[model samples]
Target: MPFNWNWAFTWEILPKLLHAALNTLLAAGLGYAIAVVLGLILALAQRTPSRAVTFVIREFVEFIRSTPLILQIFFVYYVGPQFGLRLGPWTAGMIAIGLHYSAYLSEVYRGGLQAVPKGQWEACTALNLSPAKTYWRIIIPQAIPSALAGMGNYLVGIFKDTPMLSVIGVAELMHTANAIGSSSYRYLEPYTLVGIIFLAISLPTAALIRIFEGYVRRKLGLK
Candidate 1:
């Protein structure tokens, strides 16, 4: 059959897809939030004095970065139940995505932390500042600018990766699109709208991230 764009079908399914888009956003947002915290911990853990601790965390981060995200999602949702940890699709998806991105974000943070000058570390020591205070008040503040760009990129990346959650039945946008297409037998409109919706959100988000990065730099007086 020749390709035809059906306005009626498109309009009818718009609300369902839009509702699922909120799930997409929720997965991305909560996963990124988890990644932001856990990635920092992993990065800082590698900086600790004990070589054993650093080596273990370093290997763990590398392992996570090396693996496929889909495997992680499957493992968490399926295998986890074998270990007596039964979680819903939403929870499993969030944990999997969060851990996956945390590895990437940890590298971003490590680079940012390293970019801080040695002089600053010495300055903190000379001032008799505690390790916790030095890191929290000074090192992290300076590192934010260097890490902000990578962080923003991963924010978008995690959003894109949310489609993978559909495999585990997370009911994100792609899942809804697939369901709509399966029932209605209209693949083009549903898939096309999915792309358009992603573009609609992602393009503006990329622009806003740039603006926010600039604002952060200026506010930190690093501009």
Candidate 2:
């Protein structure tokens, strides 16, 4: 009942929490990968020549961005079944996380893509190069350097947001911590450890992201 810390209970629960942390990492990794790919597609979709397509997609992106992640997760997990998408919790959670972050990441990608000079586009057109070749070869390479910082931020952001996955029954760190606290009737240690664990991972991950951004800049000769 007091403000006492129990090392013994902490040690006992550490392994379970650590194991669940792996699930957290997996969810973040897979969700970010999905966001990276889908976000690019969404970004490119908005740049299309068709006003109808661009307007629709722009509004869709805005809708996703404006809504809550929990609502999205609930939609995917609960409402999906009505549309023949009877996915399990992990699948639904990952897809929901992916879609939620993709909206934000698409904006990041669009900023990076737009940073490419107009002359680069003119150069590609001047050479009579196809759009795919132009983008794959020249445009994307230049965009990467600008995008790395933003992408890195989302990578860490996705990691921190993994706790939301637990609402869908994904056994990630926060869910595991909750389970431990509920079972033992001890909230202090479990919650404290959760904060410590998140801090440990987030700080190092942010530092590594900065280092990676620097490495990318040097590699791309931007620095």
Candidate 3:
């Protein structure tokens, strides 16, 4: 068969993809925000002086990190209702993505924390800085650059993984593409467009993260 392009069909599906893309972006954004904050908390918990606290935190992080995200999504979605908790598709997807990525981000944060020099901690102690002040005022500033690249990578990673949410009925790009394909029996255009849309958004964002990471490392004099 000769090559054929259906411009009108492509145009007709564009708005659906755009709407789904917005939902995808929103899920990624909110999920990433939760990951960032909760990862910091997990990082801090690991660093707490109490060995019991550290052990518990490590176990929790490892458990979450080791499990597959799809299973986690299924468990949260299907099992939650049994416990008197109900979640919409979007809400469950966001929570699963957030919690799963938080485990990964926590390690990124922990690595950043470990990268800070012993002298820095000693200096803070010698200065009689409270633990909170030590972390917030001194250690974190230095650790942040180390964490920034990893955190940025995860942000892009989560964005790319938004398609996984579609399996759980969250109406993201992949779901939208599936809908279009099912309705029109035209998978080629819709699926291809989804990939192109993802690349158009993600590739630029990844490049920008690299540029910003370089600038940050140079500014911080990080080796």
Candidate 4:
């Protein structure tokens, strides 16, 4: 039989899908927030004086980045309980996603931080600015313009990857789409809507990221 579109079914399931999409957004937003902070910390840790600390953090980031996100999610959600580290599915999923992406984001941050000129550090030293002040006042402001575009790309990436959270039953968009498809025995409408919803969100987000990047560059007088 030839396939056909089902507008009525699409409309009926959309409210449910939209509700699930909220969970997706929450997971992505929270996860990205954790990633941004943790990634910065990881990047900074590598710059510290202690070689041991830098080595350990570098290895940890490498390990996280090298592994599959699904494995990490399953490990956190399932294997964690074996080690008496039990957490709810949502919590586990968020932590896994955050840790997984932080590894990548840290590299983006490292590149940004490195792109700041050596002369800026020399000038800060000449002015007797403390390390903290040097970073906050001079170095970070410069690094941010270089970092904004990469950071924004990861924000969208984390949103798309929220589907991986469904493996642990987090009930985000993909999980909900699967549920709808299973019940109705019709995969086409629900899955197609999922694609449309993702496209709708990702495209605008990328565009806004570009706008925000340009604004930051202008504000910082980098342009």
By TM-score, who's the top model here? 1
Pick by lDDT: 1 or 3, better one: 1
Query: What are the models' TM-scores?
Result: 0.97, 0.97, 0.95, 0.96
Tell me, what's the RMSD of every candidate? 1.0, 1.1, 1.8, 1.3
C-alpha positional error of residue 195 in candidate 1 after TM-score superposition, expressed in Å = 0.5
What are the lDDT figures for the candidates, one per model? Answer: 0.96, 0.92, 0.91, 0.94
Off by over 4 Å in 2: none
Compose the digit string of candidate 4's lDDT tens values, residues 1-223.
2179889888999999999999999999999999999999999999999999999999999999999999999999998889888899999999999999999999999999999999999999999999999988999878888989899999999999999999899999999999998888889998999999999999999999999999888887776
- Predicted candidate 3 versus true structure: per-residue lDDT over 1-223, tens digit per residue: 2146688889999998988899999999999999999999999999878999999999999999898888898988889899999999988998999999999999999999999999999999899999999999999889899899899999999998889898889999999999888888888888889999999999999999999999999998866
Off by over 4 Å in 1: none
Candidate 4: where are CA atoms >4 Å away? none
Backbone clash pairs for candidate 2 read none
Model 2 Cα lDDT, one tens digit per residue, 1-223 = 6479999988999999899989999999999999999999999899899999999999999999999998999899999889887999999999999998899999998999999999999999999999999988999889888988889999999999999988889999999999988888899988888889999999999999899889888887786
- Tens digits of lDDT, candidate 1, 1-223: 3289999989999999999999999999999999999999999999999999999999999999999999999999998889888899999999999999999999999999999999999999999999999999989999999999999999999999999999999999999999988888889999999999999999999999999999999998896
Ranking by lDDT: 1, 4, 2, 3
Query: Residue 192 of candidate 1: its Cα lDDT?
Result: 98
Question: Candidate 3 — which residues are off by over 4 angstroms?
Answer: 1-4
lDDT: which candidate is best? 1
